[model samples]
Target chain A: MIDLELERFVYFADLFGIAIFSITGVLAARGKQIDLFGVMVLALATSLGGGTLRDLALNAHPLIWIADPLLLWAAIGAALLTFGYCRFWVLPRRALLVLDAAGLALFAIAGAEKAMALGFSPLIAVIMGISTGCAGGVIRDVLTGRIPGILQQDEFYATCALIGASFYVLLHGHLDANLLALSAMTLIFVIRLLAIYSGFRLPVFVVA
Target chain B: MIDLELERFVYFADLFGIAIFSITGVLAARGKQIDLFGVMVLALATSLGGGTLRDLALNAHPLIWIADPLLLWAAIGAALLTFGYCRFWVLPRRALLVLDAAGLALFAIAGAEKAMALGFSPLIAVIMGISTGCAGGVIRDVLTGRIPGILQQDEFYATCALIGASFYVLLHGHLDANLLALSAMTLIFVIRLLAIYSGFRLPVFVVA
Candidate 1:
C-alpha cells in the first residue's frame, strides 16, 4: 500500500510536470504563428496526452484531467505564462531544457506508479511510464512538423525513463515507495542531464 | 437501438477499413528502411490509432482489438501482404487512394454510430467519429517523418468524414440505419474522390 505522503508528493510533482511540459509545448510553437486556441490545445495535449493514453490503455475510467480540473488549469496557465513571457523577455534555453528533463523524469515515475497501482506487470509499467513521459513531446513535435527527438538516435530521453521505471518497479516492494520514487526520478534526471551536456546518443542499426 | 444486421454490416466494413489503412501504413513506410517489426508497429498504429483514442476518450472498455483478436490479425495480415506484394509488383497508387477513401468513410460512420449507441451527444459522436477515422494516419505520418496528409488541408480527408458523420447523426432516428450509412459512405467517397482528382483544397488562413 502506498503511504499518504507518497500520494501527496506525486500529486504535486504531477502538477509541476504538467506545467513544465505545457511550457515546453508553448515554446515549441513559437514560430508556428498558431492562435491562442491552438496554443492551448497544444499545451493540453502535451501535458495530458500520455496520462490520458495510459489511463485508457489500463481501462481506468474518469481520465485524470476529468477527475481533477486543476491539472487542466495548470497546463493552460503555464502555456499562457509562456505565451506572455516570450513576447517581451528573452528566455534562457538551458534552464528550460533542465526543467524539461525534470518534468520527463517526474511524469515517467508517476506513470509507472499508476500502472503498478492498477496491478499491471512490471514490463507494462515500464512501457506506460516511458509512454507517459515521452508521448506529449512526441505529440508536440509532430504537430509542429519536427521529427520527434526521442524517435531520433540521439540523447537519453525515453531510455532514461525506461531505466528509472525499471528501477522503481524492481525495488518498489523492498524499499519505501516514497524513497524509491525519488531515487528513480533522480536517476532519470541525472542521466538525462548528462546526455544533454555530453551529447550521448544511441547507435542506429544498419541493415545490409 | 441498432439491429443485428446493422451491427454485422458495420463489423465487416470495419474489418475492410482496417485492412485498407494497414496497407496505406505499410506503403507510407517504403524507403524509410525500417525493419519488418517497425513496419508492423507502424501498420498497427495506423490501423488502430484512431479507434484506440476514441475508445479511451469515451471510456469504452475493452478496446476493439482487445475484444476481438481478428481485428489485430486483419491489420497485421494486411501489412505483411502489402510488404510482400510491393517487393514484386508495382502498386496502383490510384487504386489505393480510392480504397483509402472508402476506408475513411466506413471508419467515420462506424465511429459515429458507436458513440451514438453509447448515448453521447450528437456533437461528441461527430468529434469521436473524426478522431477515430483520422488519428491512425496521423500517427503513421509522424512515425514515417511526413506531415500528415489530413493535417495538410490539401484534400477533403477529415472534412469528408466530418460531413458524413454529421449526416448520419442528423438522420439516424428517422431512416433505416443501413441505408443511411450507405448514403453517407457514398457521399464521403464521392467528395474524397473529387478532391483527389480535382486538386480541391481548403484555403489556408493567413494571419497578418
Candidate 2:
C-alpha cells in the first residue's frame, strides 16, 4: 500500500513531469510544419505515451489519463502555452536539456514506484521506469521524422534512468519509500546533467 | 464467448498475419544499415505492436504473445527468413501489397471481435479494430525514419480497416460469427486491392 503522503507527492511530480515533457515536445516541433492539432497530439504523446505503456505492460486498469483527466488537461495546457509564447520564452538549448532531464527523473521514479506498488518484479519495475523516462521522447522524435536520440546519440539518457530505477528498487524496502524516491530522482537528474555537460556516451557497435 | 472452431481459425490467421507483418518490417529495414538485432526488434514491433496496444487499451491481461509463444517464434522465424532470403524471393511490389492487405483484414476482424467479446462499446470496438490493423505499419514506418503512410498517403488503407471493423461490429450479432468475420475480411481485402490498382487516394489538405 502506498503511503497517502507519498501518493500526494507523486501526484504533483507527475503533473510537473507532464507539463515539462509537453513543453519539450512543443519545442521540438518549432520548425516542423505541424499545425495546432498535430502539436497537441505530439505533446500528449510525448507526455503520456510512456506512462500509458508502463501501465499497459503492468496490466494497470483504466489507464492513468482515463482515471485522471486533469493530466490530459495539463499536457494540453502546456502545449498551448508553449505554442503561443515560445518566442518570448527564448529558452537556451541548455535550459531545454535541463527541463527534459528533470522530466525524465520524475517519470523514472514514479514509474518504478508504481510498478513496485503493483507487485511487479524488480527487473520489470526497472524496465518500466526506464521506458517511462525515455519512450515519450522517442515517440516525439519519431513523430517529428527524426531518428530517436536514444537509438542514435546514446548520451547515457536511458542508462541514467535504468540506474536510478535499480537504485530505487534495491533500497525501497530497506529505506523510507519517499526518501528513496526522491534520492533516485535526484540521482538520475544529476547523472543526466553530467552526461550532457561532459559529452559522455555509450560506445556503438561497428559491424565488421 | 468465442466459439472453439472459430477461435482455431482466428489463431491461424493471427500467426499468418504475424509472419507477413514481420516480413514486411524486415523488408523495410533492408537499406537502413540496421543490424540483426535492430531488424529483429523492428520486426517484432511491426508484427505485435498493434495487438499489444489493442489488448492493453482493453485491459486484457497476459498479452496475446505472452499467452501464446508461438506468435513470437513465428515472427522471429519470418524475420530470419526474410533477412536471409529477401534477395532470392523477388516478390513483386504488387504481391507485397496484397500480403499486407490480407494481414490488415485478418487483424481488423479479429481485433473487433475480441473487443466485442470484452463488452466494449461498438464504437470503441471499431476503433480498436482500426488501431490493430494499422498501428503496426505505422510503427514500422516511424522506426524506419519515414512518415507513416497512413497519415500521409491516405490511400484508403486505414479507411478500409475502419469500414470492415464497422461492418463486423454492426453485423456480428445478426450473422454467424464465422461468416461475418470472413465477410469483413473479404471486404477490406477487396477494397484495399482496388485502392491499390486504381490509385485511389483521399485528397490531401492544402493549407491556405
Candidate 3:
C-alpha cells in the first residue's frame, strides 16, 4: 500500500520536474536560432538525463524513460509549449533560474528516495541525490557551451541537495511516508530558493 | 592469445578516441569565454560520455571513466593543450569537424565490439554502437546550443556508424578480432568522411 503510493508520488515528482526542466531548457536555447529539433533535444537532455544517470548507477532495469512513455510525451509537450512562447517573455532568464531550482529540488529528493529503496547506503543516497539534481543541468550547460552551474562557485546549488538528502534520510527513518517525502521536498525547495534569493554561495578553491 | 591482443588494441583505441574527443571539446569551449573548469568538464564529457552511456546500458561496473583514471587525465591534458592553441588556428572549425569524425569512428567500432563481447544480439550491438559513437557529440552540441550532427539531415553521421556496426557483426564470427575491428573502423571512417566531404545527407522529415 505504502509502496504503491510512494511510486505514484515519485511519478508525479518526475513529471513535474521534467516539465520544469524542459521549460528551462527551451529558454536556454533562446537567441541561438536553433531549430525545433535542437530545442527538443536540449529539453529531453535536461529532463531525462539525471534520471538516466541515477538508474544506471543503481543498475535498475528498464530505464525510467523506457518504462514510462508518458514521461517522454509529457517532456515533448512541455518543450513544444515552451518553444512556442519563449520569445514572448520579457524575463525568460529569471523564470528559468527559479523553475530550474524547483526542478532540481524535486529531482534531488526523488533520487534520494529511489536510491534508498534500492538499498544503497546513506552516503550513496546523498551522492545520488546531488548527482541527479545537478548532472542534467551540467550536461545541458556543457553541450550548449554555457558554463555548467556546478563548476561555478556562485550559487548554493548542489550543496543544498547534499544537505537536503541528509535531512531526508534522517527524517524518513522516523516519519510516515507522505510526511517524510513532503518534508524532504520542502527542505530542498526552501533551502535552494532561499539561497538563490539571498545570494548565498559556495566558495571556490583551486585544487593543486 | 588473440583475445588478449584484442583487448590491448581496444584499450589503445579508447585512449586515442578519448584524446581526439577531448581536443574537440576544448576547441568548442573556445570563443565561449568559459573558465578553465568549464573547459575541462566539456572535454571530459566529449571524451567519456559515449563510453559511460555504453557501460550504463550494459550494466557494466565502475563506469569506464571511473575505472580508468588514465583516460580522465589524458582528457584534461588534451583540453588544456587545445585551449592554449585555440586562437592560433586559422581553420579551427574544420579541425573540430574532422577530429570529431575520427572520434566518432573509433568510438562506434569500439562500442560495437564491447556490446558483442557482452553477448548482446547483433541488432542491440549495432544500436549500442551508434548510441555510444554519437551520444557524446550530441551532448557536447546540446550544451553549446549547436545542432547535433546526428539529428541534422545535412549529413550522414550516425548512418555511418550503423553500417559499420552491422558489418562488424557480420565479420565477427569469421575473422580474427584485430582484422574485424580494423575493418569496422575503416568502414565507418570512410563513410563518415565521404559524407562530410561530399555533403552526402539524409533527408529531414517530421515523424508522421
Candidate 4:
C-alpha cells in the first residue's frame, strides 16, 4: 500500500511541475510569433515531453496524459494563462529561473522514483531522472528554433538533476521515501539556485 | 504466422531507412561544428526518434535498436561515413532530396504497418506513419538549430506520406502485403519527387 502522505506530495509535485514547465514554455515563445495552436503545442511538449519519453523508454503504456486527462487540462490552462498575462506581468527573469529550478527538482525526483518502482537499475534510474528533468526544455527550445540552453549554456541544470537523482538512489533504501525524495529535490533546487546566483558553469569541451 | 518474404522486405527497408536518415542527419550538421559524438547522437535521434515514439505510444517493449543491435551499428556507420565523405562527395541537392524521399516512404509504411500489427486504429496508424516519416527530419533540423523544414517549407512532404499511409491502410487486407507496401512506398516517393521538381506546395497558414 502506498503511503498517503507521499502520494499527496507526489500529486502536488506533479501538478505544480506541469504548470511551471508549461508557463516557461509559453514564456520562451514570447517573441516567436507562434499562433495559439503553436503555443499549446509547445506548452504540452515542455510540460509532458520528458515524462512521455521516460514512460516510452520504460515501455510504460497509455502514457501519463492518456491516463490522467487532468494533467493535459492543467498544461492547457497554464499555456492560456501565460499567453494572456505575459505581456502585462512582464515577469522578471529571476522569477522564471526560480520556477524552472523548482520544476526541474520536482521532475528529477519523480522520474528517479518512477524508474526505481519499475525495477530499473540505479544508474538507469538516475539517467532517466536527468532526462526527465531536461528533455522537455530541450524539446521546447528545439521547437522554438533555439539550441537547447542545457546543451549550449554551461549552467549546472542537468548536472544538478544528475547529482540529486544519484543521491536519491543512494539513500532511498536507508531512509523514508518521502524524506529521501524531499532531500534530493531540495538539493537539486538549492544547487540550481546557487549556480544561477553565482554564475557558476561547467567547462565546455572545445573541439580542436 | 508472419510471411517470411514480406518480413525480409521490411527488414531491408528498415535498414535502408535508418542508414539514409542517419546520413541525412549527419549531413545536416555540416557547418554547425558539432563534434563526432554530437553527430552520432543526432544521427541516432534522426533514424530512431519516430519509431521510438511510435513504439512508446503502442506500448511495444524492447525498442527495435534494443532488440537488434544491427540497427545501432547501421546508424553509427552512416554517421561516420557521412562525416568522412561529406566534404569530398558534396552530394547534389537533388540526390539528397531523392534519398530523403525514399527514406520517408520506407519509414512511413513501416510505421503504419507496425501500428496496425499492434492493433491501433486506422487514424492513429496513419498519424504514426506520417510521424515516422517526418520525425527524423524534424529532429535533425531541430538539432541543427533550424526550424523543421517539414513545418516551414511548403513542400508536400508529410502530405505525401499521409496519402500513401492512408492508401496502404485501405488496401493492405485486399492485396498481397509486399505488393501493397511497395505500391504505397512508390506512391509516396513519386509524389514527393514530383512535388520537389514541380514546386507543388500546400497553402501556408499565415498568422494574421
Per-residue accuracy of model 2 over A1-208 as CA lDDT, tens digit each:
2465778777777888999999999889877888888999999999999898888777787888889999999999999998888767686777778999999999999998888888766866786798789889989988787876665544568778988999999998898778888899999999999999898775432312
Q: Evaluated with DockQ, which candidate comes out highest?
A: 4
Model 3 segments beyond 4 Å from truth? A1-4, A87-91, A203-208, B1-52, B58-130, B136-208
Tens digits of per-residue lDDT for model 3, B125-197 = 8867887888888778777777675555565777788889899988897988898898888888888789878
Could you tell me the lDDT of residue A47 within candidate 1? 89
What lDDT does the true structure give each of the candidates? 0.83, 0.84, 0.80, 0.83
Supply candidate 2's per-residue lDDT for A59. 77
- For each candidate, the DockQ is 0.10, 0.11, 0.10, 0.12
Error of 3 at B73 (Å): 22
Query: Which residue pairs in candidate 4 collide?
Result: none
- Higher-scoring candidate on DockQ, 1 or 2: 2
Q: What class would a CAPRI assessor give candidate 3's docking?
A: incorrect
Docking class of 1: incorrect
Over B1-208, each residue of candidate 2 has an lDDT whose tens digit, in order, gives 3465777767776888889998887777655556554566678789998888898888788778756778978998998887767645565566668888998998888888888888999999999999999999998888888888798765679999999999999987798878788899999999999999898998888899
Q: How high a TM-score does candidate 1 get? A: 0.61
Cα miss at B7, model 1 (Å)? 15
- For residue B145, model 1's alpha carbon misses the true position, in angstroms, by 4.6
Instruction: Estimate candidate 2's alpha-carbon lDDT, on a 0 to 1 scale.
Output: 0.84
The residue pairs that clash in candidate 1, if any, are none
| Residue lDDT tens for model 4, B94-135 | 767888999999999999988888889899889999998999
CAPRI class of candidate 4: incorrect
